[model samples]
Target: MSKFEQQLNQQLHDLAKEKAPQRDLWRGIELGIEHQHDTGTVPQNRHRRLAAVAASVALVVSLSWYGIQQTSVPATDHPTGQALVKALSNQHEQQKQALLVQYTDAPAMTENWEAQLAELDEAASAIKAALKEDPNNGALLRMLQQVHQQQITLIERVHAPQWQQI
Candidate 1:
């Protein structure tokens, strides 16, 4: 079970009405029993259990909503940075999927593509390192590859007339 569940269970069990104010426990029980009695009678533990369930649901929903908000925000495009980010995203997904499966790669990919891919791979490595130091920044991580791509490609192609072909 999760920490939330564990805490809830402890709270439920530790509701000892003894030395710690009988009035409060009685009030809770009275309120619970009144609700139960008004609803034409229910089991003693039902209200307590319901309260715990509602708390758990609220906690889970809050966490899920936060996650959705985080993932739903769009990243801004920065040309080569965008391309590099796309590649990194592909790799991240592959890494996640690898936990559940295995795959094999073809033997004869091009050396030229390898060098281009390596530049991206290096940038991704640096971005990941930065991310480890600051995990809250999805944009920084996302911008990593694309930023380097623009710099590297521009330096290599700036003198050539055919850069427009890029």
Candidate 2:
């Protein structure tokens, strides 16, 4: 071994022979325990407070979620509702036609895409019929919009998948 390693070993031997300084730790621990007992407050109280806070937070979150669901779409009268529906339908048709023209020669990934589109169209028609009866129904309007979006997403996915580009 080199001189540095020999010196390190000698230091380690000297440390091993030395005795540790002694102190009474039990008195301090006992004092702390007595003080805690006198205060009448335990760790369980902290846990209870944490649980209560968690419950309140959960309740607030649930209420906010419920409120959002209830007010997602605003109610509208017959004329305004009909106009909105017509506008959305016109835009969807234009987009669909444009996409079809763009992918005329490209083959779709799935053979049943046309059937899926037909199903979504039928659903849209049903929602429209429901809207005619209750023009101010916000939920129905939301459903119609969701179905239209789904149709567009399906068309896009079938024509040009993200994985295909990679």
Candidate 3:
């Protein structure tokens, strides 16, 4: 044979020799049956398989129960969140309108000062109500702090001596 054909034949022989036999599953079963007959107790380990199956079933049931229980909890919006928002908005609007000046040509503007003050007081009361609802809300608490400061300043402004020292 030529050198190339000789090398190919050797490779093919090696491949054929390396092929492993198929498994004889029935032989293993026959051996197990013979062993069982000899031992009379079978050595089956069925108890271990049963325990594993039971553990898997228990895990499934526990997970299913947890999923059901978690789904049943009702989520709701906090009423305090609404109150906090209202208080913040009320303070914001009041601050915006606090700079209003009486128009000299508008009689209605000059005539309604007391009524406007009453409305502002009502707004302040709403802010206080919001604070009562959400005492722990940071935004509401900060607004409340500002409200107290504004109240003190307003009182001081009203009570300060008018040109007495001047």
Candidate 4:
């Protein structure tokens, strides 16, 4: 035969000679079936399997419950967080009211100054409500602080002499 054909034949022969699995898996299955049939234990095995599945589910649920309890913040921290937010908001409102009263007689550069302040108040209230829901959220607290600061700055800027000219 040619060199290429000889090589192909050798490859085919090697493929044909590949060994099968070491053990007969079907024999083991047949023996198990026979044993179950002779002993009348099929129903018991099914029940055992069901019990194992139920135990695994219970274990998973217990672990999840433990994880949630562990990850939750301490109960004492919740009130403290809300209290801090409350104090800051009270202080902000007092300052905002004072600024509004101070600038009431002053000529505001913007005609819609009250409307703008109302918008800021609305935004602050929304943040405050969100904080009530998630008291420990630092970003929400910071945003509330920023909105209050903006209100103060707006009041000052609109009543300033430079803004009046512009």
Ranked candidates (lDDT, high to low):
2, 4, 3, 1
Worst 10 residues of 1 by lDDT: 99-108
On residues 1-166, what C-alpha lDDT tens digit does candidate 2 reach at each position? 9999999999888885666659888898999998887885777688889999999999999999988976885655324677878887899889888888888888899999999999999999999999888876889989999999999898888999989876
| Cα-lDDT of candidate 2 | 0.88
Which model scores highest in lDDT?
A: 2
**Which pairs clash (backbone N, Cα, C closer than 3 Å) in model 1?**
80-146, 81-146, 81-147
Backbone clashes in candidate 4 total 0
TM-score of each: 0.26, 0.52, 0.26, 0.49
* Residue pair clashes in candidate 2: none
Residue pairs with clashing backbones, model 4? none
Error of 2 at 44 (Å): 34
Instruction: Give candidate 2's TM-score.
Output: 0.52
**Model 4, span 121-142: residue lDDT tens:** 8999999899889988989989
Worst 10 contiguous positions by lDDT, candidate 3: 100-109
| lDDT of candidates 1 onward, in order | 0.60, 0.88, 0.61, 0.87
Local accuracy of candidate 3 as per-residue lDDT tens digits, 49-92: 77899999999999999899768865443434555556665765
For residue 77, what is the lDDT in candidate 1?
A: 36
| TM-score, structure 1 vs. true | 0.26
